[model samples]
Target: MATPPYPPPPPYVPQPPANRLGGKHKTVLGCGGLLFTFVLIGAIGSACSPTGSETTKKVPGPAVTVTVTATATVTPAANAAAGSPKRAQESAPAPAASAEPVTAKARLSNHVGQQLQAAQDAAQAEGFLVLTSHDATGGNRMQVWDRNWKVCSQSPGPGTLDTATTIDFGAVKLEEACP
Candidate 1:
């Protein structure tokens, strides 16, 4: 082949552009992208997070107090002889003694040797809760039936004058086979 024109212009080789971004500029862009991704993820997570609807707010005005009083009215008798003292006396009801609310306190009682149901009933009647424990020390287990179980001992023994709301009872089968 004869020298082709300009000797094929010495194979063209590609070169990087002179105005390309520097290393520092690339690093700054990468960091900014990562920060934007993290912020976006955090915002989405917070939007989807579980939260309660109720908001606690303080009242703006002074607290108001209210008092209520009750009154009793007597109804006149319809079939009595016109203006009769006997009728008036019979129609008027006697005034009730000052009514006061009564609260019953639990009085620890001797429940040992008593049936579990009876003990529980007695305790509940006195406004107390009952906690029963099995006494299965000697290979004897408590039965599911309350009546079949007998209390062997009690905590805070009878007449202690302590207002414990809950009384614990140690019980076993009624056969008395267990110590």
Candidate 2:
């Protein structure tokens, strides 16, 4: 048997110091580069701050001006009464009168037609206004009165004296037909 020959080894080439950065040196250089970048950014920011010139100053915002004026012409005291009506004077508001119903000496019980008259008389005596009177039901008439003897509202409600008390003297009327 013949012996086979072995192949020769390939030639070897030496590598140069391919790495430019060493471990600690690389860390220091990276830190220095970062510091330089930060300083450059800070310088740019300082340059961009307002310089009080038209281009560096902020644009003027919308200018606004507001003015208000009021004028009043005073009327004389005597002339003020000319526009108001006579009735308005009569109806001049009074202090809220005692809400407690006024007591009547005459009992309104069994008094239908006479209810209005009784209310009117009671109101007159009490110094209230008697506006008008009309029949509300059989034996019942309502009378209306203002704070003064001025009639305001009336109806013929023939219930009783107690019932009429609540009617505020305004529902008593002196009419023949019941409303």
Candidate 3:
């Protein structure tokens, strides 16, 4: 028996080009790289953002005009008689005297005593109607209450003020309680 005349050459298998990349693999890799870049940029922006001591620009406000107009009006007697403001119908009357403001002076006994009369007088003098007067033991002075009170001046010196008008003189605690 003799060998075949032509020995078959090794099978011719074709190889793909080296530089070619898969379409799906390239798309996925590019997209992943783009997403990573975007995420990195976003993180950097957030970190540098004005998280502390942030400031805002103030927008200019619209211009405004203040136009003042008198609201007073004059009416006839007939209208006033029909239950209008009496001031409109009556002849202009003389200006009434201005009442003086109320004032008061008081002395606390031994820093704690109920000598409220002095306070009352001072309040009357200053044109204030005394409502209630009491000893402010916690405040170490006398406190007088009224509709409106103010201490024009104290007799001795700088004293504690309870209200705009009411004040406390120097406190002197008595050895014995007042009768």
Candidate 4:
């Protein structure tokens, strides 16, 4: 066999693509995703804030701390008949002595069949500041998420209650039936 003057060309081999997207395209997409995440987070934070104010202002004056204090007085029923409701009276607010829950008169609303969070909101709206809940079935389960629980029963159901009173709510999981 005679040797060729030039070496034979290497056999043709297929090569997979290095990348479906270029570095520049990947970077752009990553940046877009990051920006979207930041915008989402900011929107959630702004929406969840307690107040609608977008910014806070600094006043050049003596810093004063405001405290809310209240007291509730329930008068005995004029008619000592059974099932009669007593009236609640509000006295002058006293100075804040401690971190104890303020005792004010808050009307209690019927919270049965409502979400725990809604129940709490309603109680607060009714002027009841202090509120709490427990497992209605005596399962000893704690309500970790207020929105996931439903109010089965409430203490001192639907009446004028003292703000200082700890409204006890018996709640069950949203999927569970109230006992």
Top model number, TM-score: 4
- Model 1, span 1-179: residue lDDT tens: 77656654678789977968899999999999999999999999878753322222222322223344445556656635577878777877765455444333444667777776677777655546545556645544655777667777777677634334457777886666546
* Model 2 local distance difference test score: 0.42
Instruction: Candidate 2: list runs displaced more than 4 Å.
Output: 1-4, 11-21, 54-179
Pick out the ten consecutive residues of candidate 4 with the lowest summed lDDT. Answer: 54-63
Give residue 49's lDDT in candidate 3 (0 to 100). 54
All candidates: CA RMSD (Å): 20.5, 36.1, 25.1, 18.7
Q: Compose the digit string of candidate 2's lDDT tens values, residues 82-150.
A: 776655555555434334434333222222233434445553433333234433243453223311122
Worst 10 contiguous positions by lDDT, candidate 3: 106-115
On residues 1-179, what C-alpha lDDT tens digit does candidate 4 reach at each position?
99999999999999997888989999999999999999999999878964432222222222223368655554444453444443211232334444555344645667788878877876766666678889999989988867778889999787665566788899998778977
Q: How displaced is residue 76 in candidate 4, in Å? A: 39
Instruction: Candidate 3: list runs displaced more than 4 Å.
Output: 1-17, 54-179
For candidate 3, lDDT tens digit of each residue in 78-162? 5556665765547544445444544333322121222234444544433333234322233434433321222222332333322
Most accurate candidate by lDDT: 4
Go through the candidates in order and give each one's C-alpha lDDT: 0.63, 0.42, 0.42, 0.71
Score residue 2 of candidate 1 by CA lDDT: 71
**Per the 3 Å backbone cut-off, how many clashing residue pairs does candidate 4 have?**
0
